[model samples]
Target: MLIATTFSSIASAADETVTGIELSYDSWDYNTSTSSLEVFIDDDAVIVSLLAATSSSSTKKDVSASATWKSSNTSYVKVDKGVLTAVGKGTATISATYGGYTQNIKVTSDYVYDSVQILKNGSNAAESYDVSLGAEQVFTLSGIKSGASNENITTNATWTSSSSSVATVDDGTVTLVGVGTTTITAKYKGKSDTVKLVVTSPYKSLALSPKTLLEIDMGDDDQTIQAIATTTSGSTETVTAKATWTTSSAAVATVEDGVVTPVATGQTKITATYLGVSSTIDVVVRTPYQSIKLSPAKEYQMMLNSPGLQITAEVQELSGNDENVTTQAEWTSSNLLVATVTNGLVTPKAVGTTKITASIKGISRSIDITVFPSVTELTIDKESIDTFPEKSETLPKVSGNTFGGDTADVSKIVKWTVADEKIATIKDGKWTADAVGKTVVTAELNGLKATFELNVHLTPVKLVPSTKELSVVIGKDLALPTITVVNQDGSEEDVSSKATWKASSDNAIVVNGKVKGLEASKVTLTATYLNKTTTVKAYVEEEIEKLVAEPSSLELYPGKSKSVKVTGYYVSGKKVVLSSKMNWTVSSSTLATVNGSTVKALAVGSGKLTGSYQGKTLEIPITVSPKLKSLTLSDKSLKLSPGASYSLKLQANYTTGNPVDVTTSAAWVTNKASVATVSNGKIIALSKGSATIKATFDGKTVSMRVTVK
Candidate 1:
């Protein structure tokens, strides 16, 4: 027989737990003295257990018993009695048997249970979290449990990074590093849970919109380009861009920083590149050509024989693009035989239409020019003289003619004819005149006839006398010659009325017609008619005569009152008059006294007496001798001195009827200072000696010395 209890020995336990059982204790205790068993189970399962007791008298009694489980199953189990016991002091087991089978269970009272739980604070169970790369994520762990109160439980949780480049986790917190997928593990007490953390890069995908080419103008640099970029992963990204420019023809076109320029007169292409992608652009860089234009752009006209004309041309426009410009321009004319051009200057050589053209940069323009015949006219004025003497009295008309034409040969012939044959005549446009009169004249030039009046004037004719030939003493009238004009019918005509007369010298003469002034002299006369002038000479002569004083005879006595008379003569047919007062003088004051034309002797001396009448005067000598006291005669009374001789000189006073004779005597002597001696009323001196002589007259003797040596 066996008794069964629902307990097992708690001393033995495996290192690892089995599927559904936990060991309550590692050791068990039993008291033999009280015949009781102590049971210890895991602390979580330490409640009562079902066991069956059986008494056994012998070692093998029937011990099939049934026991009811308390904390486990409600079913009863039969155990053999040998299964209910404790192997150690702190272990217990129960076994029970109902039929032939028995089962044993172990329970421990000294077992302790410890556990920990991890949870996110204030979060749902299955929610996901997000964080940027190089950023942080936090989580909290809670809900931990231990088997008993006041039990010492130790726990440590570590965070592990699945990918260091992507993310890392520590103490249930996670941090993102880069752009990739990673896991964050939370571990505690040899338990771990992993959370997936993906770290994405901040890079964006770039794309250029509108993949077509563009066109830009040459030399235009003011332009900008825009494009769009997108990220593959629904994230924001940053993109950078740049551009490069190129040209197809470097010489013709050049580009810098997406700008293109044209260098010559040609076309070229330019392209622009942006970022890592490239685009093509069509650009035309063209140079322009220049064209010339003529002002007056149509036609010009001038006379055939006109003065030189002027023409000009100018540059109008330049063709092509940016590089087209005119460098130089020139001008020329077509049909140089009719016209010529030099440096935009045009000249016509004949009467025709000529084209003048200007050229610049392979472009040209032309102008038409025409020349025509010229006309001239002639003007004539009445015939007249331009110059005439101021002294001319007769009227002299003047006239002229004017001629103008393209040729000087138009004035080949000119003819003139006068009407009055005697006054004036014309031949071959020349005129001649003989007298003072008005004459009609006609002039013909190249068969064109014209008429004029010519005036012919007579020159004044008169007798002209020198101023020296005119006399105030002569009471005579002077006459001047008269001038006459002949008429066309051969008749004499008085021309004095038409003449102008004037004295060539002033104060010389005055005249009226054929009459002369009181003072006579030559004069000039001038006459003019029909623009013609002439001159004539005139003369006047007169004579004058008068009585003048002269010495006919006169006598004076020495040392005595004696007088002499003077007389004047007047010629026939002469005008003469005597002055009221006569002029008289004596050569010696002591010898004579003159009153009027008479002289008186004062002393015994010889002197001359002079008298004047009108513009004439005369002088005469008078003899003055010494007074005789008595007469004495001598033998040499008639003797003469050597180298000296005396001739008989007889004197008679007409009023007194006295005759006197003088002679030199031989006894009379004459000194060298005395010239001769006298005897018988004459004395003589021999050999320049002096001698005494006597002159007897009226019983008075006069003695004088005559010396001769």
Candidate 2:
């Protein structure tokens, strides 16, 4: 067998230099030639070295060919190529010279009487040895009483095997060669010992299982291949996990340990090697296996009355495989109420969501489903449900008919939404009343919305009188208190109709939403709502003894304003400002106007500003004066030639106002048209003559003379 050989260390040596020569080996060196290189007979071989130039840190070099060797006492020791050999037991000196530099090595070969013994180690005794097959054995030999101290001699003990074909020994290490018998011996100084030995083979051939393999599809699970090794002694062992595995074509298949994975569509060989024996199997990786998928794998949606859609499943078959088997695929629905699938036809029903599944041959796929409602008609029997606070009741029924004429009772199925959950809530046709107030209750079914109002009547926790005081003109009625019904949760609601009202004195007044002014006497008004009562005070004013406009008199200019106040004197001698409460008007709107208590002057005229309440009326004397002093024409005279025209304008100069344009308001005329004609401040010339043009504004006139060109 061709054994692959592999070819470390500690040291104790001091370097010595002499003249220009350096001794490289510290184990054997000398100061001078007389004691230069020293070594023992049959000692571990050591090399004598000489270097002209070197450092201890330099890499050690064996330049035996470069140096000449010399030896003293050639019979006892010899030097050849710087290597000293002991031929007899004696002392000798060895030396080497290179490049004009020389170093010496002294040798001491001992001649001592010694016996040898055989052992597993401690060389010098064992020259040849045997080892059992399938194992490595170490042999040893020693010289008895050989040195001056009479110790075992181990150095320079040569080792060999009698039959190298059966066993081999290097130094003292022995390796078994075959299963056979042999003899081993150890010798030293004409003394020797022999031992009979035998070696056995522990391993033989390795075999792989599934000697022939079928083609495997790509993506197939990894497969394990078994390995078994047999010994020459007829014993077998499993080494699958320990055996090294390889694939001829890793692109087609790959093997790790004993597991094989098909990679691509090709053929490859798998080999398992154990104990130097290899076994192989063929592996073919074919295309992947066939599969199936639904057309809409993600999700599908359908609406009521929408055109029917066909659900399909396609089989992605392998080469030479069967065609699509959509017709044979089984169909199922997660919700029949939401949608239905029959013979691949998906018919949407009421609104909801569901999952549709398809199965064929052992493969299956599913689609997420959503069905929206299509309502043809929605109906609820009631507009509102009535319940007291903190009460419960069954909600009214609701029904929905789809466009497909399918009717469903949605009273319990519909989702209920409430504007105020504190007021009322509905769940599965059950209503829970929480507080007082009316809230809209909406029901949603089949995508259509329907609503039934919820009225949670306030349980009379307390009543609040919204009206505190009332002032009414004599013989005039006043609005009554708007009683607020408070619920148990400190909530208030206007429930005026929920309570009956009785006046303390019907002769004095009556209360409902209002109290009528029946008499001038004091009266008590009471309001009740939801069986809760609250009271308010009311006093009708006595008939007015006199009525007057405050400030007694007034004066204003045209197009000016004045704020007025009206006061009424009662029979009790009290005065009240009735300007806002009384109906206000002006005697002549053309002159002035009064809205509430404010008066506007329309022109330079006077009108009575009046205030009235409860059939009593009062008026104020007012006066308005014009602000203008005179009216004048812009041009005193307009001269024109016959066949020419001229225009004249009028202006009003005021006492307190800025000059105002009166041209548009002035009346224009010509006294003699033969000379010139004036119309609307424009003069047209006909014949040559003089004429007088008159402009009038607000009963005042200005004249101008004109001549035609």
Candidate 3:
């Protein structure tokens, strides 16, 4: 029975003990679970032992008494214990094992019990702020929120600012510093937000009035110019700055920043600009001038043909700011009569006084100029009353001539002095004859003197032949007579040395002062002195005489012969042989022969007769006539047979001045009709008949008979 009872007990325990539980959770909540389990217990309040069960193992779970479980109202729950405690979540099984017969229960947990809340440092807050220069600004972040939590809430958040100096935010805190705008950004949990901060200043800004400037000046290291520029607003904010520069006109001036440099002595415009505005200042450039002083400051003098004089001036340095300065020197003369300047060289043109000026830059300084005249000197060779001709006399004659001295470049008064009174006397620069001798004359002019010797000789009187009696042939020689002279003492003197002979006719006549050649029909020989000349007449007859024959004698024969006769003459009327006796000759002997003045002919030929006289000769020709003879034939009579013919030829001897005509013909009365006739001295016989053939020449006739038998 105990074994039966234990077995029965086992079966009952299985049916009553806890098995498994199911759960429905809306959220984690303990009150809903407790509430739902209470309803199944039939008591609102019960002490239940909740046992949790899993598929692997089982155990009785415990819960606090103060825990509450809640769920949806329609959900069911079973309790395995008398007391029910709410647990947070899930499903479980419960059972009671007091009696041997156990009872089982099921429990389910379906509920949500967690809550979320948000907190803030302040309700209304600012994220950014603005501050003035040198002033500080601060800002605090607010309006923080939480989704759900009963645990500690600690997380890393980030904040960033756009301009650090102007305004900045750190860990939701912001600080403002300098000017400009600032942006603050807060980042958390991959989300970000931004805020802006602006800073400004009450003070005005400063800047250079003109942003850029250009300055210009002449090319000088010391050249300076001023430039000005203005600012918009400020007391100490007005700032000035120089511009770094280069030069396009370096040959004139160079400018660097605000400084200027002059390269040469010239004018140039310098432009100085500053900022965006500019004002220009003019810089004047000056070159040092040179001062000059002329040498020989009082007067200058020179002489003609003298060496050139140099006029110079000393140049002094002047004080000034200058560049590339130079000086040129020059000179001038007021009048060339006193002096002249050629490239500063002076020469005298004449005797005078004038002013010489030295000039520079249109300003002139003057100096006096003076010139002295040259001295004059005169002298005569002789001083006395002399006899006649003097060496210093240009046209000395027997009466009395003065001797004048040569004067050149003489201007001062001259005084005359005679060394010897016997030969010549001097008045001015002239001398008068005193005696027949030589003397010296002197003249003085302003301490300068000169002397000359004078010579006086006796006058010579001349006599010459008269030209009216002179005569000469075209080509011949004649002797001229010498001119005779007499002195003042009436005594004859040899004047040939002092006399000059000339011919007053054609140049064909030549005279050598003493002798002359007769060259024309008439010529006059003249003897000349210093002022007088005498002519002499002379005659020259032709030396060669002409002779001519009144009628030349000539002879000739009837054939040809010549005879020539000539005559000649001489100045002495002497007999001369005739030209026929000198060169007369016969040309041909066949035509003619000549013997002295006679000519004879041996045959019928031409002859030439020639005669010579002086340098000329003459020729004569003669012709001779031929002897005549009557016409004749070889036979006087010609016989011809019947039916035969004959020819007759005739010849004649005739003399005529020219060729003559001769003709012949037959003159016969023949009974036979067959007989022939003759013509022009030719005969032809024909048939049987007798005829007469006759020839006539120049009206003369001759006859011959011809017969044909």
| C-alpha lDDT of all candidate models, in order | 0.44, 0.68, 0.47
| Residue range 150-237, candidate 1, lDDT tens digits | 3222134566777886666666666665666776655544334556665653334433322344333333343433333344466533
> Would you list the rank order by TM-score, best first?
2, 3, 1
| TM-score pick, better of 1 and 3 | 3
lDDT order of candidates, best first? 2, 3, 1
Q: Candidate 3 residues 558-606, lDDT tens each?
A: 5543444454555656544454433455677576666656667666656
Model 1 scores a TM of 0.17
Model 3 alpha-carbon drift over 4 Å, by segment: 1-421, 438-455, 459-479, 544-709
* lDDT score, candidate 3, position 295: 65
| Model 1 regions more than 4 Å off | 1-442, 446-478, 481-499, 503-512, 515-709
Candidate 3 versus the native: TM-score? 0.21
Angstrom error at residue 70, model 2:
76
- Expressed as tens digits, the lDDT of each residue in 406-503 for candidate 2 is 87565645677888987877664588888878999887754678888887775668887765555555566666656677778688777666656666
lDDT, model 1: 0.44
Q: How far is 138's C-alpha from truth in model 3 (Å)?
A: 99
Clashes of 3: 76
